[model samples]
Target: MLAMGEVHTGLLQNSGEISESTCRQVLGLMAGETVRVSRRPIPHALSPERLTGVDCALPSASRSRIRGVGTVVSRCAVTGGRVAQGSSYVRVVRSEADRRLPWSHYLSRPGVVEVLGKAKAADLAEGFVGDPAPGCLDMGAISGRFLDLVQASPLLDRRAPFRIPRTSLRWVAETGEPSIRFTLHTEQERTLRLTHPGPFTPAVVDLCEDLATHDWLLTSLLIIVERARIGATPGAQAVARLAPAIDHLLHLWMPAARVEEWLRPFWESLERQPGFTRQWRSLVDRVRDQIATSTLALLSAATEAGRR
Candidate 1:
């Protein structure tokens, strides 16, 4: 069995981070289900998972007609009440029968899709991680729509400080030798391939979401830093460009905050290679240095004016 999912991450369309109550109101998707909130390392809120039924062709490298039927799990999340994300995923498994089954059968097993006919896990994984052909199972779209739903909520003012595009992270996990591979295909597209030593679990999903959250943070910060034009523009002006990031993003970089303990090695391994935290800290330090220099310049000018 393979667990494939996508997460869409972006800024919450509000001038500032929303309050806990507001976060609840914005993420309240299902009627009876509760929105879970954690306030330790950061104020995070996650909506109850909602299932969407799908009967589509599984992405195949050889363009095979591997039709699958099941519900896809989706939910919206708010991190520090500033970053919003929509996640959707489905577990793919081969079915005993070779044809379509009743809707209720799929409905009963939420977030599990049964593929009809023969299909190789590697083929599907390759097709998905690479450029997927049109009309394949589109978890990215489902996740994006969920994000759009939250962004369009009346609770928000639709006044995001920065207008950065959302980042989409597609991931696939299978049981194997416990390794992780993260690839950035484009500014907005990323993919992760994971091999765990045991059976697939929700912890895998948590790890993916956590990585997606941090990756989006790093991407957004880089954009902000470039826009600051540190040396090209006046120090004060550059600092002004970075103000929104300091206000809304810098403090939200607690990696693996939600990941299970045993799975932390995966994050640590990535840290050694691409060095997500290393780059993030460098950006943070640059932002701070710019702010400090600008402040000093302003202070010196004020003192000189008073003396004159």
Candidate 2:
């Protein structure tokens, strides 16, 4: 794809490498009549730059594809040399060649997020490319949505909805024990099946629990941090430090980019502050470890839930 920043930077330029059919598919998804793409040389392998990651802007008619926004993450032994397995980066991949490349191919691998559908893809693009969360706003939005969904669910009663329709309420209803959100949209009947097993159901449940719990931890922690910056109890300061760290530990399965961007800054902030007492740091570390343990347990839960 065309690199927005580099296109103007007078970088190595190439001609069309994408087939017409692929371009049509991409344009259809984009809902754009006219679209432009750039081609680049792709060795069988990659040459990682000194940076493990870089922000790339790809121009597109719509915001749907990369257009002056998007960041690519990769694993590099050197600056930009070899890409390790499971080292997929984010981009508006459209062509077969685009998807065939290792950086694009690995994104679909298990343990990585497969943001199905345009809506979810937009969210992913926004999170990666657009200004995300903007500090606590993202945290607040997550909390608000989670609580709304939880409140919407049947509280472990009323058969707890054995099955939920694929509507806006799909994600909320999915919290029920032993639930599987169907891969195929109910309307479209495709004769496809995943060659590999989906993530363990137990892990999904655990992740759900962790996410549910995180609403409280991060939202509350942010509140405490704001109040304490003006000076509060050593105890209060200690509590703030622990919240984001635990959030990190619990969110282990998430894309590292998201985790690093969201939680790491907060952890660093707490570390730099004078409020944490020795005992407080110890307590926070303990909770962080607990979150780590819980993350692994989550996978088991998701797996077990699938079995039942």
Candidate 3:
């Protein structure tokens, strides 16, 4: 069995974190489906799960023809009422019959895709992580549509504090000795390969979402600091450019906040190698110092003027 998914993370297009009632209205993707909410560690809400029918070729590294037919499960989530994520995944399994079944047959098993022909798990995993070929299952597009639905809601003012591009994380997991490999492909793209000891579960999906959220936070902050041009630009001007980070992006560095205890080790392993929090703290401090210096300069100028 294999689980593959993509998560798109970005800031909510609002002035500040929204209220629970507002979240309910914005995240209500389907009728008769309750939007789950948890208010403790952080205010979070999830839209009801929705499925999209998919009958496409499964990506394979060996160029072997592999076709899959099934539905892809997707949902929208808001964390701290500030961050929005659209996550979609499908479980791949061998079909009992080597032919295309009726759509209803596939719909009966939501989020599960049955491969009609021979396909190795390794090949599928590699193809997904590597460059995607044409006509392959486009989970990103499905996920993007769900995000678009939430962002296009009239309830939102569409005034995001800053214009940070959405980041995407593609992940594939299979049953084996526990192991995880996360790779940052580009500025806006990341990929992960994992081997878990037991059966695949939604807890794994939660773990992926958590990782994507924190990675996006780190990436957004780094972009803000770079654009500030601290040494080259005037102190006040640099501070002005960094204001968004202070106002909207900082204080969102919580990692593993929603992850289960069993998945803590994965987050820990990522911390040791990439040092996500370490880098985030350094950037936060730099932003604060710049703001402080800018304030002092303005004060000193005011005092001199008074003396004159």
Candidate 4:
């Protein structure tokens, strides 16, 4: 649906956030469930104001916010990874496991709503010996190696140095458990909880990331909207909103006409992007290639899990 260069070009045109209308269209395509929408502000937890460029760990979904449901819980390991030191835990008290959370949940702590968060962006980009400059535009489809970072097992940028900040799959293999643990916990100290089974494996991890990243691609999109509030003109402004094409993947079930219709106004606000035309071809191909490879690896791993 993304057709070749469109998705990444959109990413180049718009930084990372994808508009909600586009998200609904994309999600409708991929799932059987009805897609819901809500709008809210970013949480203080993941706020740069709180961390002050410290590059803190990804924000955790707050169980406190969601109302009257079965409990929501999440556990994370702060092992010797690139960010954070102490362990992390989240629980939506009395919330249902499948319960829909408040929209704010997606803003500050991306884990609750979207798969790939700012932490993933800043940290995941590590270890590239020859990546363009830090300021250069980074546009491309989601890659497979990146999908590995989504898994509960440990993740490392393929280019990580062999020293302390390791990136290979070794930690998971060594632990015989997914190094990045996630679970439902009851107490601050985790007196009660639910946990995902061993290995958390390459397949499940990426699947979760894909789910979350899709959401991230949608909601945090308000970030671009927020940028527009300041009166920045299109092309004159850095990319901030969803491109019409990206909705294809997330809003798979939506009618194409409605998607384009929704995107029409948003399009009027576009700021022209520089260089997106020049570097787009090879970058898009590279991203698609990565996706193709990751798709196979995840499917094979999931298939084995099912067979077991």
**Candidate whose lDDT is highest:** 1
Residues 94-176, model 2: lDDT tens digits: 34322223544443432222222232333432243233333211222222232233223232122211121111111111111
Model 1 Cα lDDT, one tens digit per residue, 116-216: 88899999888888888899999999999999999999989988898898999999999889889999987899999999888988888989989999999
| Local error of candidate 4 at residue 130 (angstroms) | 28
Runs of candidate 2 exceeding 4 Å displacement:
1-129, 132-147, 154-219, 222-308
> How do all models score by TM-score?
0.98, 0.20, 0.96, 0.19
Q: Write the per-residue lDDT of candidate 3 for residues 28-86, one digit (tens) a residue.
A: 98888889999877788999999999888988888778999999999999988889999
* Candidate number with the higher TM-score (2 or 4): 2
Tens-digit lDDT track for model 4 on 1-308?
00000010012112233344433432232245444443322100110111001111212222112122111111111111111111111211122334445555433442222222122221222211122233221211122222222222222223321112111110011112122222212211101111223422223322232222222233223333343332244321222222322232222211111122322222122112222212333333433444455567679889999999
The list of candidate 3 runs beyond 4 A from truth reads 306-308
Find the candidate with the highest TM-score and give its number: 1
lDDT of 3 at 21: 94
Candidates 2 and 3: which is better by lDDT? 3
| lDDT value, candidate 2, whole model | 0.27
Q: Candidate 3 versus the native: TM-score?
A: 0.96
Give stretches of model 4 more than 4 Å off.
1-194, 230-308
